[model samples]
Target: MNSYIRVSLAVLLVALAPVHSLFHPGVNTITPDAPKLRSLGAQQGILRSVAGSQNLKSQDSLRLKGGVTSILKSLKDALFPVETWEMPKFFSMSAMMFMIIYIYTTVRDTKDTLVVSTCGAESITFLKVYGVLPAATMFMLYYSRISNIFSKKALFYVTALPFMAFYAVFAYFIYPNREILHPPIPQDLDERWKYAVSLLSNWSYSLFYVVSELWGSVGVSVLFWQLANDIIPVWQANRFYPLFGQLANIAPICAGQTVAYFAHLSDKGDDAFGVALQQTTVLILAAGACFMLLYHYICVLGERD
Candidate 1:
């Protein structure tokens, strides 16, 4: 009976010893599942990243991780002189240029068409000499004086806002009411100097042509550059300007198509020009507003970066 009890105790000890080893392993014991746990954690991190911030705006700058895609992206960044975070800034500047050029094209085309169709082509030469020269001179003086008194941002608003507002007002009120606004002239007024007189008679169109010219010279050439230079450093601007120019070139094409489409809207009847003018003005105002917005955003980015 004693031998049987001792043998049963020995068997219990052997079985329990292995169970104790599992709960309290040796110092040098390696976890069998450690590698798999690490791999699963890594996979989950990647999945979380993929599910979150899909737009990549929140993504960390890609490290040069020796992958093919990473290497290509790095090269692209180098060539463009831009980081992932800088894309919005870049695109905003480009879009601003686009809007500027679009407004210019739309206004200029319509100006020329109005001049040639109503006042004769020769009147353009006269207006360029008399109207544009005087207006530009005054504007240059005004710009020079205001530059001293106002901040660049304020100056931009002063210079640009008036043009946009006047354009809107002209489209809605001035041009449409030109016949009533103009002076009564002889039906048989066929003098060579009659072209200039006719332009003077249709004074709204003359004013429109002059404003359009000043817009090209001042609003576009001066204001746009001022805004661009304010946001981007010269070193970085060189890389961006060429691309901006190329992208902005599309605006002219779009303007042409817009004009054509509206001009051909025979359903508008005799009011086609009026409808086109109003629609184009809306676009110009929208573009001007957006350009200012982008300028503000880029300025914010510049401050932050």
Candidate 2:
């Protein structure tokens, strides 16, 4: 067999392995050891002491004033640092990361909701077999090949521009034609083939799920972290990483609200799925572009140093 064919089969097997494990019940299950309550209590006490120490530090700082002003000052100091060159990079990267996480969450939710609604539960298993697994393997391969050929900065554009174009095309043309692309299933199919045929019939939605899953791996995990580590210095990272992590936690709350608001708008429409897809596609593409631009600026800054 050709090397490509072998790789393709490997990808399929790897995808199917998870589903196989899920079916075999106790084959994978192991009895849990008894909980170590004494050890757990000790760890909880240690955590409480550490948190108490941090709270004391904040209290010390806030005690300078006696009223609400003291509380406000402490909160402000905790969130925002004294301004420095690194501060802008920190804020920009945090904002970009927020957009990336928000868009990924929104798109993934939209795709999964659409798939389950349109094709049902078994379609999810079929999609893993036919869609996500292949896309993930091919993405890794593409990233590997490109990392060897392109500079980190160039690689961002190489990967991102194509995806932006894909989303754009999907939003403007392909998504609108989703119903046409996924035609009604034939009544004559063999019983064995019917389930598979039903899934294949909803190809457009499956493809959406595949692409949305890739955004987390390729767009956020690979591209964003690579750029962050490249720019952020080791010494500063200890202090700044925690702050940015807090910002990351807050991002999901904001993203959830944003998604809910759009979902509300979608509910008002006659074609809710179509409206949601259109809204999410535009948001994903816009976020992707902004992330690329921010990354380009970071690259430029790195070169200047």
Candidate achieving the largest lDDT: 1
Tens digits of per-residue lDDT for model 2, 78-197: 776535777677888887787778777777777778788877877787778878889999999988999899987788889878766766777678878877878899989997776678
lDDT of 2 at 229: 86
- Candidate 1 is scored at a TM of 0.73
* Sliding window of 10 residues with minimal summed lDDT for model 2: 25-34
TM-score of candidate 2 to 2 decimals: 0.69
The true-structure Cα RMSD of candidate 1 reads 11.1
How many pairs of residues in model 1 come into backbone collision? 0
Clashes of each: 0, 0
Give each prediction's root-mean-square deviation over alpha carbons: 11.1, 37.7
Please provide, for model 1 over 49-168, each residue's C-alpha lDDT reduced to its tens digit, 9 standing for 90 to 100.
Answer: 887876464344343234668778878866666666768888988887888888889899999988899888878888999999999999889889999999877887888889998999
Scored by CA lDDT, what does every candidate get?
Answer: 0.82, 0.77
Candidate 1 Cα outliers beyond 4 Å, as residue runs? 1-81, 187-190
